[model samples]
Target: MRVALGVSYNGQSYDGWQSQPSGRTVQDQLEKALGKFADQRISTLCAGRTDAGVHGLMQVVHFDTSAERAPYAWVRGTNSFLPRDIAVQWAHVVPDEFHCRASALSRRYAYSLLESPVRPSVDAGRVGWVFQPLDLAAMQAAATRLLGEHDFTSFRASACQALSPVKNLLRIEISRRGAYWRFEFEANAFLHHMIRNIMGCLIVIGQGKQAPEWIDEVLAARSRDAAAPTFSPDGLYFLGPRYDARWGLPDRTPAYDWLP
Candidate 1:
């Protein structure tokens, strides 16, 4: 059986989402947990990869099983094996052809303003809280300019393995809630560190270090260093993927709200 799972985590302690040979990683830990809990040597595929220090509020993944498993078996079993930092939020059986990555139509992500030099009592690991204040209005204006399909060469990591720099940015929204600033985006796909780099540029303007309109110059530069700086990984989150009906998971509830 093919299964889809919802997971969330505090990425501060691991290297990243993908398994790595050198340091600890979310994938490696999950695989180990699967071995212990499911007792089936199960492997999983995620909707997207998040870097070390990045969090996930609603990440998705798929795995295969040799025999039928109950919904709670995946949730309860996986949770039992996983460390406290990672949690299996939910699970459902899915079609064999359904993929956590390839079958996704779009993905959404969010980042935060993590710093405050004046009053620094905030949680240390969630968002990229900067010391200085940010101009939320200006940041939102700049974010709106990033919508649409474009070559994000300027913001992608130099080591990014993606074949193309062009991606369809479906939405880029900015909102402020008291001292917290939110940067949310939805796109067909993203290059490695693309969102972080973009956040870096936005923060520069928010702090009045650069003009909001500088987004155009950064995108046109098509170089990693051209943007402000990669924002701290703490504020980033791999939200989830959206799928079409044809690629539906077998046990997906009508409540899954897979559609927008």
Candidate 2:
């Protein structure tokens, strides 16, 4: 049987999502827990991979296992062996044809920022920080140029392994509440550091360092050198993949409520 699970993790302490030989990644920890619970080796494939210092709200994964257990049993059993920072939110018995990555219609991500003069203390390693007051209108104008499909080479990391730079950006919603700013993005797929790279440009533009038209120019250039540096991964979150309703999977977890 194949099982699909919704996972959430604080990526601050781990290397990243992929299992590493160092055995210090979210995947490594989760797989270890699963193995312990089932008393058999287990492996998983995820819908998306988040960078270090990044967080995940509803990262989906699937694994093939001969261990037969109730859905809730899998959830409670696996989580029992996991650490405090990583958790298996929910689980379901999925069809053999269901793949967490390929079955997704779209992926969503959120970036949280603190726009205050003081550096974060309690929320350290949880949000990106900008001391300058942002010009919301200018940033919104700049974001309009990125609404549709385009070759996002300018904003992609050089180490990105994605075959192509072209990606359909379904939406970009920026909003603010007090000293906190939230940027939500939906896309067919994302290149490595795509959102962080774009956030770098947007931050500069919002700070009045550049004009809104610069985003268009950068997109047209399709050169990595034309864009701003990649921003911090602290604030980035893999909001999760959107699957067809027929799958009957939950879109979000409790972690979503805690984020801005």
RMSD of each: 3.7, 0.7
Which candidate leads the pack in lDDT? 2
1-260, model 1: which lDDT tens digit per residue? 88888888889999989989963888888888877876768778899999989887777888887757688887898899898999888887878877888988898888866546763345677767777888878888788778898899998888999999999999987877677777788999999999988888888888898887889888888887778778788778777787887654433323223211
Give candidate 2 misplaced runs (Cα > 4 Å). Answer: none
Error of 2 at 5 (Å): 0.4
The local lDDT score (0 to 100) that residue 151 gets in candidate 1 is 91
Instruction: For candidate 1, give the lDDT.
Output: 0.81
Instruction: List, residue by residue over 1-260, the lDDT tens digit for candidate 2.
Output: 99999999999999999999999999999999999999999999999999888899999999999999999999999999999999999999999999999999999999999999999889999999999999999999999989999999999998999999999999999999889999999999999999999999999999999999999999999999999999999999999999999898998998887797
> For candidate 2, what is the lDDT?
0.95
Query: TM-score of model 1 relative to the true fold?
Result: 0.91
